[model samples]
Target: MTLRTATAGDLTAIMDLERTSFPTDAWSEPMMQSELASPHGRYLVDVEAGRVIGYGGVRAVQGSADADIQTIALAEAARGRGRGRTLLRALLEVARERGAREMFLEVRADNPVATALYASEGFVEIGRRPRYYQPDDVDAVIMTLDLVAWAAHRAADGTALDAGACS
Candidate 1:
């Protein structure tokens, strides 16, 4: 598998995954196109055999003190293999590179797997937005991570957080 920055050419594949991953709340193609064209966003696609298997993005204006994880999704076959974690770390790194001191995201309250993934990445539950997910009426669990502390912990453990690592 390979991960790289996303481009307009990958929009079709991305939309496919987005619709499949979030069947009820998928962003429209126009919205996704706008996101890809946004100056404050950095999006990435994970590919295998020239096919996109996962994608994610972060919104971080240059010199900003904080960033938001816009979205992250992987094909069902790509889950539970650390691919989501890899995509997440890459998005976080992009945010950090853009001078963000902290990162924030919202996950569905009913999705334990996603919630656990964020928690394992040093993100703490800061608050909640009741009934934030429409149609399903699921709450949104807001989480935040301190980039400086996260980097320090990684350094202390001697584990390099290389976003480009293929394995």
Candidate 2:
């Protein structure tokens, strides 16, 4: 029932969530460990009753602030009750705080739920790449969101948009 900044110690649980939530595209343990340890990325995790339930992270790059919505997954038993939205906003907030004005990500075009969530957050469909996701050969549709307003709104409203309405 709480959200906190992610730390290296959270990797084991984070990896578990990744494995279950994104079976085909989960980050390797080393990669999650590295990103959690990174000085360049901002990671936020949701924990409930001492277990990691959800997490999201982003890294700023170049001058454009290209960001990767590294991972977002709620523990299977923890799904529903709006945990995902809260985790997502927490990550976006951190990204903006770290000088990210714009963010980019690729999602499976067929994931209408995720697509709608991003769209609600002001992420617009920009372009697409054929077979961006390997093995399954599923295409990834690129989406971009302007964090300037997202930041301003949160600052101005201060959680006016709660965990249930991130998208």
- Find the candidate with the highest lDDT and give its number: 1
**Candidate that would win on TM-score:** 1
Model 2 residue 164 CA deviation (Å) reads 20
Q: Which stretches of candidate 2 lie over 4 Å from their true place?
A: 61-66, 155-167
- Candidate 1 at 11: error in angstroms? 0.5
Q: Could you tell me how far off, in angstroms, the CA of residue 19 lies in candidate 2 after the best superposition?
A: 0.8
For model 2, residues 54-157, the per-residue Cα lDDT tens digits are 88877765344656677677777876677777777767766665667888888898788788888877789999999988777889999888888777776787
Count backbone clashes in candidate 1. 0
Candidate lDDT (C-alpha), each: 0.91, 0.76
For residues 30-129, could you state the per-residue lDDT of candidate 1 as single tens digits?
A: 9999999999998999998989999999999999999999999999999999999888988888887788999999999999999999999999999999
TM for candidate 2 is 0.85
| TM-score of every candidate | 0.95, 0.85
Instruction: Pick out the ten consecutive residues of candidate 1 with the lowest summed lDDT.
Output: 158-167
lDDT of 2: 0.76
Looking at model 2, residue 112 earns an lDDT score of 88
